[model samples]
Target: MNKLTTLNDHYALYVDGSCLENRDVSATTPAAWSLVIVTGDNGLGKGSGEILEETWGSVITDSSDSAFIGAEVGSNNTAELTAIAEALRWLLIDGGNRPAIVHTDSQYAGNLATGNWKAKANKQLVAMVQKLWREVGALRELNWSHVRAHRGHRWNERADHLANRCVNNQAPMPLSFWKPGQR
Candidate 1:
């Protein structure tokens, strides 16, 4: 298990994914991914820390079909993987050199990205995320932590909400500027 390096300035990114009709997903299914980046570590509770950034969007598929353009050909796994990729991409480009930890509820994603489990499906997406993980490691410390879903974990629940909102075509909440403990 890769442990997070102790750092006061490290960032915590809570990510989640949502898919509409997951069991019946097809080439036109809707799925979305979201991430909430924060600082501080009062544990992973509601007031865990102050929100530094929040982002959510449709999950783009590897397919080139126009009908399946944005989030159409997506599944829960794809959304989960994409959320991780986007979070790492953000850290690589805009996160300075600060160490960061990504918290996710998907054990599948966590295991695959950290080499704890071999991927049997979605090889391409898995490869992309693994590559990005390596790239981010080259610059600063990056680690993954498994967070249980829907257990009232603040940022994790927020990420779930944002992803669901995106899947429903609703506007995302402005959590980036939201102070801790504010409803």
Candidate 2:
């Protein structure tokens, strides 16, 4: 049985979007993103592979951003936004109301989330993410920051792995460990 434990009131999430197909049109390629929750322990949180002290990894099924100019599937931007939205959504539903610091290697994702950048292409998709963040703000404080990619950051590496797993159509390891509300 999973044990009840006191968790940090806040979490740091390293998010990455991976598109290994290297196609000009994302519609023809597979792309994915991941958000790895950072904890005091280097190991997986409490059970199986819980992201934080207690949270599940999210897999986004919708790859297309059909807003403004419809974004093709497997686009790195879409994947990044999807990861961010899923993280906020999960935090909202979990009702932990804990503050979150989101780290993204993509300057666009980080800047846009923090209102430092404007969307010129995927306007609709950006709007949707903005809406989600606003909703998250009602329940928890959210901060956005940028991180250098391929620098050997542990959480970032894990997130990168998760993103690649999605591209390969493989499930994130944590999903096989436990289900939300089960432990």
lDDT for 159 in candidate 1 is 86
lDDT of 1 at 85: 85
Residue pairs clashing, model 2: none
| Per-residue accuracy of model 2 over 18-90 as CA lDDT, tens digit each | 7755567445566666767764422232322235632223233345523222334557787787677766766
Best by lDDT: 1
Question: Candidate 1 residues 1-183, lDDT tens each?
Answer: 345455357888888898999886775688899988888854456656777888988887746744232333578988998899889888987858888888999999888877678888778778878888889988987888888887777788788888988988988666655433222
- Against the true structure, candidate 1 reaches a TM-score of 0.85
In the predicted model 1, the residue pairs found to clash are none
lDDT of each: 0.79, 0.62
Q: After superposition, how far is residue 109 of candidate 1 from its true place, in Å?
A: 0.7
Provide C-alpha RMSD values for all models, in order: 3.8, 7.7
Off by over 4 Å in 1: 1-7, 62-72, 173-183
